[model samples]
Structure formats: structure tokens, C-alpha cells
Target chain A: MKLKDIIAALDAEVVSAEDLEKEISGGYCGDFLSFVMAQAPAGCAWFTVMSNHNVAAVAALTEVGVTILCEGVEPDEQLKAKAVGRGLDLIVTAKPVFEAVKALDL
Target chain B: MSSLHLEFDVAGNNFVSAGSASDEVKKTLKMLGVDPVAVRKVAIAMYEGEINMVIHAGGGKASVDIDTDKVKIVLADEGPGIPDISLAMKDGYSTAPDAIRDLGFGAGMGLPNMKKYTDEMHIDSTVGVGTTVTMVVNLR
Candidate 1:
């Protein structure tokens, strides 16, 4: 599914500039940065409450197309900037992580 | 030279920039045309080491070398050294406080994860001194 479609379906707010048309094959949810990096599938929508800068790095290394910060978590500006720097997109939502993951319908 | 060297000084107690070195390593590998899987292994190994340095060792230095068939990573820290390498390497062993866990790390997975992704891993530590981890990822 296209990331833009997932964003719209989840009502997530984009925090960084990037192409939303990118396709993501699956989803993985984990707050542990190392686990996410080592195990997450590429092009997956990463759902997590962890909005730290390292999240962006994990997304990049795992080649996840976008990060969905859940549970009303807002991306810190530094995190947004870093995500942008790495060619990754960040979005936030008031929805719980499970709810957001369901929205992707992957 | 069979290896190309890169260095980064990791700042301890700085959660904000924990993965900087690893990200740089990933970018470097991509630029140098390394295999995609090898790049992933090197990035994950170095990143876990960097986070350990920041969360437990109060910061450290990371040195990496890229070669035709292997990528080598060495991380050194001056924090209170590991008392037991065997215990530390256990998949679920970690000494990090709750605060570190709250950040989504320190789940006793760092060292094991590092070893999991690399082709070869070694650890050297001195009590009341520091620790050094050397890892290699082979491209072939």
C-alpha cells in the first residue's frame, strides 16, 4: 500500500517533507531501536511510541519508508529534522499503536 | 590499503545522538558500493555498540574499516567495565537502568544483537577501566 493511503486512513499528521507515494510492504511495531533495525522488514510502516532520533536511524537502516509515531506522541523537532535528513518520513497520531497499525491494513 | 578507515567519538549520556555513528557507517557503506546485506549488518552492529556506549559507558569512540570482503568495527569506552563478558553476552542480560529501558533500549539485547548480526565478535573489558568490542561482517 502507498504510505499516503495509510496516512490518510490513520489520520496521522506528517511531520517531515517526503514523498508519501512510496509503497510499504508491511508493518512492524517495536520501541526497541536495535530490534527494529535488526528485524523490521524493509518498506514497512514502523509503528512505535519511540520518537527519538535513533528511531530515524533504525528506519533508515531497515529501509522502512515511513515512521508512524503513535499514542499522541509528537515528533520532536530534532527527530523530524534527522528523519528528513535521512530521507525518511515521520507522522504522529493520537491513536494507539495497534489502532494505527490496523489502519495500514497490510 | 586493503581497508578504508573511519572514526567517530561517541558522547556518553547523550541519548539524543546515539545512532549518529551507525547512520554515518550506513551511508559510507552505501557510497562505497558495499553489498546491501553487508551494509545492514555493519550498521546494526555499530549502532548497538554506540547505544551501549552512551547508555552504559557514558560515551566512547567507534572506529570502522571498510574493505573489499569485510567491514570491521571497534568500539572502545571508558565507563565502568563489564565484569562478566559471558553474562553480558546473554541474550536477555543488561545492566541499564529503567530510564534507559523507557527510551526503548537496554533490554539486555544490545550485546547479543551485535553478535547476532556480525560474522565475528569479540569483547575485551577491564574492571574499573573500560571495554572494547571488535566485530567483523564479511561480504562474501
Candidate 2:
């Protein structure tokens, strides 16, 4: 699935769009940055309620396809700036983590 | 001898910029044509050490030496040193306050993750003094 399709399916709003055309191999949901760093599959969309700046770092370090902030969570200002500055694809959705993952049906 | 050497001052308690050094190192490794898997390993290990410095030590110094075969990361800090290295190595052990945990860290995975991703790990810490962690990830 392409990032744009997943965004449309979840009705997610773009927070910092780096690559909407990137392919999404799958998804990994977690809030713990270290856990995500260790376990998140490369090129998979990361679903989490974590809104802090470290989220961007973890997403970038893990090479995730895109970071999807679920449960209506919004990225903090630092995170927003970092995402844009670092070219990290970040999005937000009203659905919770599980539902957002389900909606993608990946 | 290393082909490249880089250093950074990791700001203490600065969660906003905590992983900047690691990010830079990852970029350097990528640019040097290091294997993606090895780059990811160095990135994860170094980032974990950098985060530990920010959360525990009042910031610290991180230096990286990239060679043809391996990347070595050294994180040194002057903070309340680890009382027990063995215990600190435990996967679920952490002394980080709940506030840090709320920010999505301090789950006690930092050291373990560092050890997990790297080919070599060392800890030199003393109570009431400081701590330094060294890790090396070999390029494949």
C-alpha cells in the first residue's frame, strides 16, 4: 500500500509530508521509543500515540515508511519542526491505534 | 586507524534534541557506504547511548570513529554513576522518573538495546562520579 492510500483510508491529516508516494510494506504499533527502535520493521508505517520529538528520531532511525499518530494524538511543536526539517513523513488520525491499523487492512 | 571521526555534545535533559548526534552518525555511516544493516545497528546502539546520556547524565560527549570494518561509539557522562552495572543491564530495570517515561523513554531498554545491536559493549561507571559506555558495531 502507498502512504497516500493508507492516509485516505484512515482519514488522517498530514502533519509533515515527506513522501506520500512511498510504499508501505506493513505497520508496527508501539509507543515506547526504544521498543519501536528495536522492533519496528523497516519501511513499515509506525502507529503510535507518542507525540513527542523523539518519535521523529525513532521513526527516522528505524527507517519507517511513515509515522502515523493515532488516537487523535498531535505532534508537539518540536516534533513537527523536526519532522519537517528532517524530511520524515508524519500523519495523524482520529482513530485509535488498533482501529487505524485495521482500517489499513494490510 | 579510523577513516572518519566525529564528536558531539549531547544536551542533558534536552529531549527535543536528544538523538541529533545519533542521527548525524547514522547519516555519516550511510554516506560512507556502510551496509544498511550495519548502519541501522550503529544508529540504534548509538541512539540508545545518546538517550541514556540525556536522561541520566546532565548531557555528555559522544564520539564516533568509523573504520572500514567497524564503527565505535563512546558515550561519557558525569552524573550519578550506575551503582550496579549488572543490574542496570537487566532489560526492565530503570531509574528514570515517571516524567521521563511519560515522554516515551526510561523503560530500561537503553543499555540492553545498545548491547543487542552492537558487536562489542563496555561500561565503565563509578558511584558518585560518572559513567562511560563504549559500543562497536561491525560492518558486514
Candidate 3:
């Protein structure tokens, strides 16, 4: 689904990169960087509650279409700017990580 | 043809920039028409190594050499080396401080995951000197 659709479906706010709405292949959720790196599928929307900047880095490296930041956690300003600079779609939701994933139908 | 070589300096202080090298390598592999699976494997493996460098080893340098049949990644770090490579290779043996964990890392899966995804893996480390990891993902 498009990133915009995911935002609407999950009731999330677009933290950055609103212009990019490329279709996502699937969803993968994890907090561990190594686990996500090894398991997360490319062209998918990665759901996590982690707000670190490396999350954006991993999304960029894995070519994930977007990142859904759950648990209502706001990323640092530097991270938000970095996500925008990297052309990564960052969405934040008030729901928990699992709820966001379920909302995406993953 | 000559091997396509690329190098990157991973900065320890910038967690956000850790995967830049891996991303660039992934793009290059894609453009080179490499197999998607192999590309993903290399990308993920190297990306994990890069993150480990930033999280545990202060910083490091990553060099990748791509050939027709395989991709070779050499990651060398000057930070404190692992005292026991075997223990560090375990899935849940992390020495990362709480700060690193707070950043969503330090779960101790980096080394194991890197080894799991690559076709061949080698590690050289000294307790106080440094560590070097060499990983290869063969494309057949």
C-alpha cells in the first residue's frame, strides 16, 4: 500500500517525507538491528517503536519503502531531518507497534 | 574484469550514518545486475558489521570487493577487540552499554547474523588491539 494509505489506515502522523508514497511489498517488525537487517524484506514497510537514527539508516540500507514509528514516540529532530534527507517516509502512530502492524494488515 | 572495489569510513559517533556504505554497495550491486538474494545478503551482513563497529568499536573502515562470482567485505575496527570471538558469536552475548541498548541495538546478534547471512566468515581480534571481520557471499 502507499505510505499515505498506511498513515490513514493506522491513524498515524507523517513525521517526514510525505511526498514519497511508493507501494510496499510487506511489513517486518523488530527492535534489534541485526535481526531486522537479517530478516526484514526489501521494499517493505518496517514497523518499530525504536526512534534511533540507525532505524532510518537500516531502512535506507534495506531499501524499505517506509518506517512506521509506533508507541507515539517522536524521533529526535536530527533523526527527522535525516529521514527527510534520505527520502525515507517516517510515520509515527499513537498505537503500539503490534497494533500498527495489525492495522497495516501484516 | 577487475574487481569493483569500494571503501567507507564508518563514524562511531553518528549512528544515523552507519549504513551508508552498505547502502551504496547495495546500489552498486543492483546496477551491476547481481542476483537480488546475493545483493540482499551482502547488504545486510555488511550493514550489521557497520553497526557493530559504531556501537562497540568506536569506528571502523569497511572495504568491499565485488567480483563476478562473489562479494568480499572486510571490516576493520581499531576499538577494543572481543576477548573471545566464540562467545561474541553467540546470538545473545552483547557487551554494549545501556546507552547503546537505549538506541535500539546491543542485543548481541550482530556477529551471529553477519555470519548467518554470508557464505564465509572470518574474524581476527586482539583483546586490546582491534578486530577485523571478513565476510564473503558467493553468487552462484
Candidate 2, B1-95: lDDT as tens digits: 44898999999988878888998998888887889999988888898998898988899999999999889899999999999999999988999
Instruction: Candidate 3: list runs displaced more than 4 Å.
Output: A17-21
Error of 1 at B101 (Å): 1.8
Error at B76, model 1, angstroms? 1.5
Q: Could you tell me which 10 consecutive residues in candidate 2 chain B have the lowest summed lDDT?
A: B1-10
C-alpha lDDT of all candidate models, in order: 0.84, 0.90, 0.85
Which candidate gets the maximum TM-score versus the true structure? 2
Most DockQ-accurate candidate:
2
Model 3, residue A103: displacement in angstroms?
2.4
User: What lDDT, from 0 to 1, does candidate 3 have?
Assistant: 0.85
For candidate 1 chain A, the 10 contiguous residues with the lowest summed lDDT are A52-61
Return the candidate ranking by lDDT, descending.
2, 3, 1
**Per-residue error (Å), model 1, residue B50:** 0.8
lDDT of 3 by residue, A1-106 (tens): 7777788998888888656556777888888776787678888888887887778777776767788888898988877988888778888999898778778754
Q: For the second chain of model 1, what is the TM-score against the true structure's chain B? A: 0.96
Residue B133, candidate 2: C-alpha displacement in angstroms: 0.7
| A-chain TM-score of every model | 0.92, 0.96, 0.91
Which pairs clash in model 1? Answer: B12-B58, B12-B59
Ranking by DockQ: 2, 3, 1
lDDT of 1 at A29: 88
Where does candidate 2 stray beyond 4 Å?
none
